[model samples]
Target chain A: MSNVLANILGASPVMPLEKHIDVACRCAEQLAPLFAAANRGDWGAAEKAAADIEALEHEADDLKKEIRLHLPKSLFMPVPRQDLLELLLVQDRIANRARDIAGLVMIRRIQMPASIADDFLDFVDRVIDAAKQARKSVRELDELFTAGFRGAEVDLVAGMIEELDRIETDTDARQFELGKALFEIEATLNPVDAVFLHRVIELTGDVADMAERVGRRLELLLSD
Target chain B: MEAQIVYIGLAAAFGLFMAWGIGANDVANAMATSVGSKALTIKQAILVAAVFEFLGAVLAGGAVTSTIRKGIVDADLLSGSPELLVYGMLASLLAAGTWLLIASHRGWPVSTTHSIVGAIVGFAAVGIGMEAVKWDQVGTIVASWVVSPLTAGFIAFLLYQSVLWLVLQHEDPLARAKRWVPVYIFFAAFTITLVTILKGLKHVGLEISVRDSYLLAVAIATGIAAVGAYFIRQIEPDPKAEKEQHFHTVERVFGVLMVITACSMAFAHGSNDVANAIGPLAAVVSVAHTGAVSAQSALPLWVLMLGGMGIVIGLASFGRHVIATVGRKITQLTPSRGFAAELAAATTIVIASGTGLPVSTTHTLVGAVLGVGLARGIEAIDLRVVARVFVSWVVTIPAGAILAILFFFVFKSVLP
Candidate 1:
């Protein structure tokens, strides 16, 4: 019988629940490198980091399944098993989103718009900062849940969200300006480059949005 | 014994229904601003209001209810005719409920409390004499209709302006303003608690000495303000020159203050408005059981509990629509602006309740929204909708009284 099948009958697992959380954290760590590579404009490094994120996502998923299977029968589990499961899923989403952004960047192979590049970079930096806070807060979940943090983490995440919203609004205006500028140069530049540039600019906003969503979900978990 | 029990039971049931309606309708007055701002979802807002409202209701004694029943209406004239008293009580309930239902269905936000007051006036005028009603108290209630909203509007305007000037207008590098946002929030929260407890919980029947109450209020307020100031001063200035971060932080803090303010309003509302549901029932109970109206009739504990529970159920089931109408339909609300409106409305109503003045929550919130709307621009006021709501307010009382009288006569004839 497979070890998984044996474990179903209540045998001790090879990798414990703590290992799964560690694996999830590792996946989140891998994502940070991918985001860094993208920020540095290193296509090759970004592609490699994206692959690492995907592998980590798979590992995290399998661990989550194992945790779920053991949850009902296990004599003891950390916090409500549902909360841990939700935390894992939120972490997985962050990694998957990082991978998705990497894929968009690689597939388009388009140049970033100079006018909005600084704004986009600032948004990404804020997202990373929120993500780092979420990770630190989650690690101290016991303290957060037992002693009320007075929703500090939630407030922090919400602040990041408001910032993301402002950035999106600014990006919308910048995109319109860039689109008009690109249209004026339509005769000189290839139509494909223009299309790719537009997609990349839009994806940048989406990536920031996804990161903010993860921050919000993590904040909810801490507060709940 | 049987007659007394039946009257009490009837009062309990009717009071429960009225409490449910109050919970269903009035909670929106507090929560609308938060929900409109998208600071909290409709579901989250209702849940929080329901819990705090229940806490406020159960912990607080029903001094406010007694005040409404005896202080506003002359029970001396109401003595000696159980049949007429029963008829009057039933008439008022039917009148208030019918008007509220019609107004709610039409999506016009109207005051259930105001409707009840009007129905009481109508029934009292018909049953005894116009002279029997305490015009002095009635005058106070009417004045509150104007006072509450205007006070709330003025406060909201000032609060929003201060927020704009202190936080939104300031140009501080290294996000220095961001650090102070939390301190300002603490002061806002402290003031909200002090005002709410002083104005809202006074009716709860603690009977604390006035000097003691004021001292406690000041102590609580100062303590909170000091702690907030300390933390805000402690936040290390950011290395990045991100002015937007400061603005966003201020906005979020403002939103938090709004939520706390809404919570205070919900608590005070339960203490004061719970009477609208129980007043008639108590009158009915007094008449059916003792065959006389007494100034000091005590409502059964079970009836009060039932009323509180009914409120929770009503809020869970039907409160969302009212909340949406107030939260989203009236106007678009940003966090800072919504906070100002909620704080203003809460402070106004709390003060009114303390001074034994009856105010309309609907009028106060509408005025606050209008104040914010004016700040935005005249075009944002939506004058057509405002006109429709105004017309409903004008018609609500007489319409409710007529409907209640009609319903009472019909039920009386059909039941016998």
Candidate 2:
């Protein structure tokens, strides 16, 4: 059974789901280059990061489309069809939000203020943490399914999801503080840069928000 | 003697034509999943179908052939004029074959079983009067039209659920699936062999009592299960693949199971569908040779073989169109899902064959697939296709009946 080759085109929901998680992480990875370019005012590097993020997001979108098109109108599955679709929607949105942030970085062209740079990076790090936790929970899904969504493993994944929510919650408070700091420094900074930077901050936060949603989706899936 | 030879030859030809239609259209319903799932290539599917359909028919075809010949029409009434019965039988075969050809040309998914049964009833009602038709048994056969697919569906639903509960739902699915593979194969073998032995082998003249058949079935099942375990034991999980493609390893296990069950499905199809072609041919041959008709006639091996040959030829000649249609429809068959549908269809068909019911393999397969859909996989199934299949079933009986009635008059008038 193990050595046997599956049809390269075999129909399973696992492939798209796995790809969605992978691309979400890849989108998150682009944040480093995106932020580096923004800080250095290297528009060239920032443009590349933004384009790559958009491309990865589209690729994930293609995978999602393939899954939807190939998913039969009727099938005998262990999970509800709607549940699987909703899970994929959140997973794809994670990448889409990351792409949006990359787009914002390119559009705003705002250099990070030297005073708030460290705090902003810390805030981005927490958002990525929440995103990673979401991806981690998605990965644990295959394991949970094999475990019949029961026993210690189910509880273990639920714990991980709870941790993701907590991380997202913590990031929210930090983001609010950062927003206040940007307003406080508005007189010293270019007013346009301050406004766009706030937009960039919110978009960056969305990636984590989408990831938390995915975690919650999985938690709901296994409660049955 | 020359006249008798000519009559026999003509009857045999019409029989072959009907068998070919069954092989062309009906056998594809069973083999489609194997090809669609990539468990067997098209060539491999043809080879498996040819060999197993032959084996199934030669081994177990007698049961349904008996039903086809005597169960619908009263041979006792025809005993006074055996030649008329012979002509009537030949007409039914030709009419059924004609209807099949027409249906195929138009791309209609009609059942071979319905056409043949309708042909028999039509000939009996018009040629020998309505009293010659066994109305009570006719009711039972009609009821089975609805019952067969539902039974197949119920079985498929249970099998798919069991696979989920026993294997896919486990904490370590690949490992758990490995443990369950032999168990699944063991049941496939057990049920296939049990039905074949208990009901099918009587056609081959190897009549085992119930106890002996059960014992033989168990032994055969165990041997096949042991072999399945050997091939399965050789597989080692690919850690890299497991990481990249979750459940790819588990799906591969089901691939092997799909192959095993595909063989059983071909065998089941052969046992039941072979009778559709040869039952009337045998009745015609016996009357031509002995110049007498009896309620019970032995199904000669050569007659059964002729039906087998006709099916193989039909598959070789006309199977492509139906196979293509099936391949297109069967889009997303992971190995376990395909296995669930195949196992259920085969089990139901074989059981029906043993009971001397000429159930439609296509109908039962549709039912089995719907069962898989009902279990939470409905997004992958098209209800429109299922609805179309039901409509085709309704059309098949009357179409064949009208054609058979017309052919009966033509044969009788020309012969006299």
Candidate 3:
């Protein structure tokens, strides 16, 4: 029902074969707002998006169970049912990860730290851009399935990956600087909080990496 | 008849030894990628290789036994002289077996074919003078050492470059890339089927015309490619992630290619090299039973089965070590690179076999590894180890021949 819930459901069919497109549309809508909140550094809004994602995941699980129950004897399917299931699981993982990042912001309960917030903001923007590209590609899956288009997609993914790597490198440099500053102001800050912040930055980078992996897989599938 | 039985026994034992050596060394060729990718554990790899190899050898092994027994050597010279024929076969088997065991223990990958040729020469020299051995056939076999690996390496290098250009270098959007994947799959399938049916199943009496076979192979390949493409297209793309997922996909595709390559290698190897073990057995059978040499002797099904079984046992018991040496120690084999090397190696051997050239799979694979290493840069290759392997190749024939001669002479003296 909510945008967050819809994004979490992703573009996959919901069950009994008829609801898949509807669920997929819901998933896309839900994901857009989460990205927006992440961009604006609205921690409370991000937490709501995360809650929507959690609810969507529950819905997907329920859908899967229902599909299994109704189609218990149905052997023939469009594709290998297991493969479809795996695809759904992987898509759901993307939503889950996005939600987890949002939840982390809420739990930290601090205004975006002034020191590295801008850098984090920039990295998030790049990630959103990549996700947007992926969504567009998925929408045009039929046209892009040809060799000419698939070849272009592979190149695009490669470029995005390179940019992601570059941003990660920059983030690492910033983290190093922040670490030194934290040590300098050790009397004012808890060392444990610094460590936690460091972990959060690393996890954020990992989410970007997971997104790239999905891009590469899509490229291989479409191009081959 | 008594003497012929003894020779057959000796031949059977030799065949078993050859099988052991193959199981010990060649199984790695098939399972190495799976093991390296951690897709299959070492123990799992060995078990799978052993079972599939044995099944492949026994169920599909045809004409290979007869080719090995009668195709290479002149049986006329040993005609009417049962004693000489028996002695020659026994001597050849022992010599070849000894060479293989030594190579295995030392972690060398000397060809079973090369060792057998040397043993045959040694026995032929003693049985009917040096003139009885077909020097031209021997020359062809020797020439294959240089030809097989170089050809395989070159082809593999090209294939890898093409894959890189098409998949890694292309700048299409994800949807477009997904669309093209079917074409690549089609090509891969076509090539694999064409090679397998024509080369792998050649010995089996699959009475289809070559043209028809090619057509059928292409159609099947296309179907497989289309199916693969459809599934791949359904997944979403996110390019700003780590590249491990891409690597993982490459690994899976490579694994499939390697399996097909291994199957073809096994089939071709069986058809061609069955002679190393059973050639002597056939020679002994003719000498003791018919008291005359004959080139047309058909190896009984039982004898061929024995040879096949021996190979299975050898692979199960002692093949793991040799596989490890080749798979890991030869060069670091990433899935894609290893697949390229194997495809090159299989293609080279198949062409050589078709043209009746007895090329060494060992040479071809090593050459492919060298080719890949050079592509990466020679500095990355361990030249000293490669040099040692090359030197061993030069010496295998002579060493095997001399051992055969010495062993035969001793057996002759002791028996009388």
Candidate 4:
């Protein structure tokens, strides 16, 4: 690297993790508008929200890249590099899943049925909440780091992970209910639409599941 | 065996080069936040640093600027062979200065204090004997490396909590800021000046008794508080900014305090680091003039001036990169947080300088910033940078020692 670029490259590894978490949180935020717009059959609005999610996911990718590129080979990290990179991958996956769902929605123009509209929206809302919970937990890395991931901070994050699991489970149950409701009406609807709707429902649930995985990745980091 | 103009000239040149490097790299740590946070523009920061650093070295550098590395090497060992000590001093300075420049070029993070100490120990062990290197004093300095930073951390933590309570969390933040900010300013001013008066400038001919120093400390504190209050009074409350961040008004209250602490930090650094550059230079001058190395002697004013001027010139020329690294790395500093970090760092440096202890001001500052991050702002800091810094701290001493060992033999063979 050139001298001017070298300083900038080696310089700001300080808070890229937090910056990454922020991008994750912002990407999670796009889910509500994306779904709400799809519910109204506003393809333009849904596509716009999906585009926003794509942009945020790209930002999170760049921050992760900056972090990886600048991470010195001889650092004395309290948490190992492999664990941090694992955490980054898992955290980035939350944004990735959200983008995936948004991309599917924009691509298929999946229309929301009146029967499952409220319940499906609630499922997406809970998934976004889980993603946010993961962001909040990741943010505690600083305190956990300063505390060396022990004592009260560990307990606090452990509690956050437990709550995230609960939220994810609750979201899972909601997805199942929405799925049941979709199936009940499946025979009366177009067969192709039923298949596509089921696929979209599973992908949306995957967003929350991936967020919970981010939390578990931290648990492994702390315990290890 | 005439050690004439040549020896003294070599010492002065190396000494000036070492001083320039410190001003460029180490001293920038003092004013970094003020420059980084835009509290002081680059030109303005450099000007402020130049003036106060000059004042600090002239007024307070004497006690510390002896012809030795704070007695780390036993000077008595070299009395029988004064010329060897001269060559050792010259070699130590060159080795340390060369290591610093190389480290900077390679983007290695290391402390100048560590560089000089390691160089002195390496040369002493080779030139005189291993016994001539004062392990007891070296032990105390090594222990202090841990003690001083923890002390600064504890100080910063308390300051952060107090600032949080006084203005950040209070219902009426403006009233609290207007009422309490100047008091904190007074506290910082009084403590630093008290240390300076009691400990730093004894050789400047004003040996005020401890009682008089206390009186002076109090008088200066109250005067500073009064002027600071006048400045605080003019800052009308902006409710919009307060609504934007409940902590905004509180941060504003700390703006003046941060600038004050920054100047104190620069002053403290000047009092301490100028000595490192000029100590060996002073020995070379003494040996060349008197044809013998006295175990101890007075530090000439001209030597102090050379150390001070070299630092200033270095800061003017090449201190920007060091300043940028310090100002922008580690953590994002708000004015209040910067105030706490600098205040704690200044306190540590002042206390260390007063009693003649060698410590890295940057390490203490980093620890203070770490302390703040531990309290409630950890998310803002980059743990990776802190880790890299720790690795650098571990590497510098051994690296400097090894390099000095190599250079000491080369200097011995080459120099007459």
Q: Best TM-score goes to which candidate?
A: 2
Model 3 C-alpha lDDT per residue in residues B1-416, reported as the tens digit of each score: 45456556666676677666666665555556456545455676666665545444443343334434544565565555547656766787888888887886776657777887787787777655787676776776677778877887787767666555555335432333355556655665576567556654655445667998799988998888666666665555445532322433444444444444444455445444555666566566655566666665545667666766766676667666645544443233544556566666656665565555555666676787666544431112434445666777888889888888888787777653
Candidate 3 regions off by >4 Å? A1-224, B39-68, B172-203, B219-241, B268-275, B286-289, B320-331, B374-379
Global lDDT of each model?
Answer: 0.60, 0.79, 0.56, 0.77
- lDDT by residue (tens digit), candidate 4, A1-224: 01211121233343678779889878978999998999998888988999999999999999889888866664334466677888888888878888888888888888779889988888888988998989888877654543445555567788899999999999999989988999999988899989989988898888888889989988996795
Q: What is the C-alpha RMSD of each candidate to the true structure, in Å?
A: 16.3, 4.7, 15.3, 6.1
Best model per lDDT: 2
Lowest-sum lDDT 10-residue window in model 3 chain B: B374-383
Of the candidates numbered 2 and 3, which has the greater TM-score value?
Answer: 2
B210-251: candidate 2 lDDT, tens digit per residue: 898888878888888788778777777778766422466887
Per-residue accuracy of model 2 over A1-224 as CA lDDT, tens digit each: 00001111125576568778888778787887778777878888888988888888899998899889866754435576788889999999888888877766776676779878888888888888887888877887655544446555677788889899999999899889999988888899878888888888888788888888998889888888
Tell me which residue pairs clash in candidate 1: B95-B404
Candidate 4 wrong stretches, greater than 4 Å: A1-109, A112-188, A191-224, B1-3, B67-70, B73-81, B130-139, B164-179, B233-245, B295-297, B373-377, B380-416
Is 2 or 3 the stronger prediction by lDDT? Answer: 2
C-alpha positional error of residue B33 in candidate 4 after TM-score superposition, expressed in Å: 2.5
Better of 1 and 2 by TM-score: 2
Model 1 residue B230 CA deviation in Å: 9.0
DockQ of 1: 0.02
True contacts kept of 2: 0.13
The stretch of ten residues in a row with the least summed lDDT in candidate 1 chain B is B373-382
- How many angstroms is residue A167 displaced in model 3 relative to the true structure, after the best TM-score fit? 11
TM-score leaderboard ranking:
2, 4, 3, 1
For candidate 4, what is the interface RMSD?
Answer: 8.4
Ordered list by DockQ, greatest first = 2, 4, 3, 1
Q: How many residue pairs clash in each candidate?
A: 1, 18, 49, 1
